[model samples]
Target: MTKKKSARQLRGQLMLQIAAGRFFRPGFPLNETEHRYTVYSNAWFIGDPPIALPVGEVVASTEMGHISSAMIAIVDRLEQQRPDGTDDFVIATGGTDLVDDLAYLMSFALNRTVSRNHDQTRRLVTGDGAPRGRSANDLFPELFEPRQTVQPGQWDDLRGFMKDLLSLSRDDFARVMRVIRNSVDATRRAPDDPTGAYTDLVAALESVSDDKLSTSVTWDRYDGSKRTIIDAALIDAGQEVADRVRAAVLEAERSGLKRRFISSTLARLSPDYYRDDAAGSIRPPRAPDLERMLGIAYDIRSRRSHVLEDLGEGVWLFTDGAETAYEPSFERVLTLAGLWRLIRHVVRRYVINAEKVAPEPWDYREALPGIVEMQLAPQYWIWQVGGLTAETATRRLNGFAEALIGWIAGQHSDGLPLDQVCQEIEGLVPTLPDGEARTSLIATHVLWHAWVDPTDHRPEASTFIDEYKAVLDAPSTSAFTVSLLSNHPMPTWSADDWVAMAQSRNDTRHTKSQAPLPAVVDALIQLFTADELELAGRHDEAVAFAANAVTELPGNEALVGWEARLVAGDHDPDFDVRTFLFGERKREVSEEPSGHEQSGEPSTEQNEAVTVEP
Candidate 1:
């Protein structure tokens, strides 16, 4: 005797057949001989012989133009695999078209099974046998019909199902409603939820009436009570049940038993019931919906506690008979982390928009408050909770600084006012703690931008130089400070003016009680005028002047280069002497031989010439 097929096996077979035929079949007509076999096999499976015969003729006579070859191949393969002595004849005699209809019918049957044993049935339907064709509607018209066609019996059945779904102990009712509504709302709000499907299901359900439900079935017993009595009863029952279940599960867990009742119950309800399925089971439990009811009880308790604490009140009894208040113990760290994530999202949005339209120097400044308000303060809590360590915090801070610098640079490049940008930078600098590497880096970046701007000749540049000098002089050493000083820009001072200022500072330092070293002043002159020793030609007097300049202002590269060139008689042929003396070119040079001998020898008069002094 053939062993009985499990529901799962039946579902799998039906799905396979439907997918194979509908998805694989070619529209082209089969050859006459092949058509007969196709019709016969299909009719036999569907328990219809005559229909299969005609369909077979149709398949043979008609041109197989639109049908897929893969579908025909699959059908052919299945037909060849029929077991010997089995009732294959039914399938063989069934018409090909009729088989398609039969597959749809099987799908409806599967759906019905799911509706009954929702846990098991849902699993099967979701996994394998689902409806394929329009004919499934014919088998279960009550489910697919428009709003007007639902018979009174079908309405009653639906109402009963709803009541079963909602029925719970009085205490559990509120919790059940809260959970369902919240879950539904959450799903509705989810970015990825299938809105169209949800809307269709809701619309369909709403069209059915619950008028047939008896008034006595409700918690208040239709007594016009402010609160429903049924709700309170259901909640109380749910709490009792949940407490027992929790005790049992905890005990099972403590014993390390793999075969727990909860697990078995969940598994039995599987295929339809997900571990995350907050909806509970479709087949209502024998006891009041305890889990759901208890949840409502917990919510009520929480609300009551909050009110009492806020009011600084004495003990207040709940006349509704809710036994205990609910308290949630979600981890504090987790909550903080969640809050931080939300804050970051908001801050990022604000920063991006602010960066786009902020005018002048205020742009970066304007974005800073939003950043602090939305991201930084909130992130501090996360850090305090050890969600992020000090090193990670430093890295994140550095990244933010770099992004701000980059944004400022981009604005400056686009013709934003340089002084305004510098002022904004100065304003935000205090927010970052002093002496940090990030602070120095940001300062350096700001100074670099100001130095590069040809038009930014404000006295503020000198003030910035003074600030950097102070930072460098501090006992705390910084590589960034060293680099900044080394690259300091020369102001638009004349050669004579720079020389006189250097001598005065030097003399005052020795004679006037050791005045400030004027480090920035010295660095500026040196970087702008440094000399290269490789130049050809030499003179003692000019070399002596260069030494004096270097002594007057140590490491004065610009002055040294000018003096060295004069002493060596290595003047640039392209240099216009008139422009050097009068600040404008007086004449242009026509083609002429360079004043050096062709044999790579210095001109004979080079050593005898007097060096020109500024």
Candidate 2:
């Protein structure tokens, strides 16, 4: 039909086509700068119909031989982009040519449909579509219902978590992901090689789990002469190398392999499980039971290795049982499901806490503004006021708060009036330290109500304002401290006063000698000024100020909302300013252990394999 068309033309030749997968949910688009391909989940590509040749979620433009590996790498990366264990970002890959083949390979690896390029014009001449021949396991679909779809708001969180995971060293990141993939594969392999699967799963843990063995050698028992002799011998033998021998000896002498494994696993577990009760969550197994279970698991792995033990045909059922319950079997072994769950936990904990990923994204001040500020605020004050690190600030704060709470509880139990307790707390304010006194006063007020009477929580607004005025007048007083001190009561500061205070704080913040004031302090200053203006009946000025404040502090939703309301002239008498940094509690506070006391270990009596929600 075209002067005898060439064989290459009749049968479409393989081209270096750029393969891409469209994620069902939003993600922060990554550039091809560092990565081999780009992720186009950002605004430019989002919601656009996939009509173009190179739609975003780009894996790579490679020769046919290397395409599968590129797809696998991309899928692996995308898997980590998930926000949490619950939700999955559906990355559906598709294209006309070898893109379909690449997507099929990805689907086979992930065991899910990643492609929808049904009308493929190209074909693999030999019909070996996947790079590696597809396995029987890939043909069967596992029972999977996505718990929830990731929301658009969570895409930034996904980006943050992914960035952290991806930032790991090549070996470390690979090892972590390898362990994770093996753990998942181990579960799937239960039907045919249950014992082998169990062995692999246990081995997976051993590979990643820290032995937590102490390498420090205690020379306290040795005499001075012997110590000197040993040191000389070490120096002669090469000091650093000799120290490794001593450390190894000490580590082996102190703890066995099993103890090390148990210790590491327990250390990784959520501390919440160690509480007296599970606090309405699933109760984790007691330490001894978990130890026993892990011991059995190790023994089983050993049995499989030494004697070639088989876990029988019903192993899959055992692997599918509820993770929070013990196996009702002859040996009372922990269910494979429970063990698998623990493996996942251990793997996740290892990857997330990897040391090289410096200053974890989740721990960043901006990510969890209020809680992180609370964590770092003590350090800030310690440096600002006392020229100390966080030696005893936390303990001191907790001790002070505990004493005040107990005193208030005791006073209330002794039938003292609530107002009298407030007065008593106000008296104690004078004896407290300058930087911490106001915080202590506010704590005293809040905790008194929480511990004593939730119904009548607030003191008379005037009494509260009067009692706090002296503290507020201090030059060290910050907007954060002020906000915590008052909820609904308008600060006595006028608009001009607020502006001057902000300027003073800003100046201090920029001063080299001074500890930097947190941005929240300035943001709150603008917010409080807006409130003052609104109170002054200058609606237009209030709107303008709030709009400017939002620009200054862009991420705070409360500021944006307040600005919008002001613009719309919608005034509600009950409206109170709420930001992620500080918000008035809308629910009754529950009695819980103080942070100082939360380190209590779990009791050994309650022994059952349970999921730790935390």
Collision pairs in model 2: none
Q: Per-prediction TM-score, please? A: 0.21, 0.31
Worst 10 residues of 1 by lDDT: 361-370
Off by over 4 Å in 2: 1-160, 213-255, 272-288, 312-320, 324-330, 357-614
lDDT of 2 at 165: 45
Report the lDDT tens digits of candidate 1 across residue range 530-586. 221213222342254345545655664544565556556764323231222222322
Across residues 1-614, which tens digit of lDDT does each residue of candidate 2 receive? 11533322222111111112222133534222112232111011121222122222333222332111122122211222334444333332222333433332223223222333211111111112432222212111121111112233333433444345455643454465456556655644543455677789888887775645312225553235556776777876876788786676556534766656656776676654445323322324555567567766777788888999765434334223433344434244554545655665565466567765332222011111111111322211211122212233223333333233332233211221234435545555555565544454444344334344335445563466456655644333333343432342445666667656555655554566433333444555566666777878877767765665676678777767777887788753334533234334332224421222323433222111222210
Candidate RMSDs in order: 30.1, 27.0
- Taken over the whole model, the C-alpha lDDT of each candidate is 0.28, 0.43
Instruction: Name the lDDT of candidate 1.
Output: 0.28
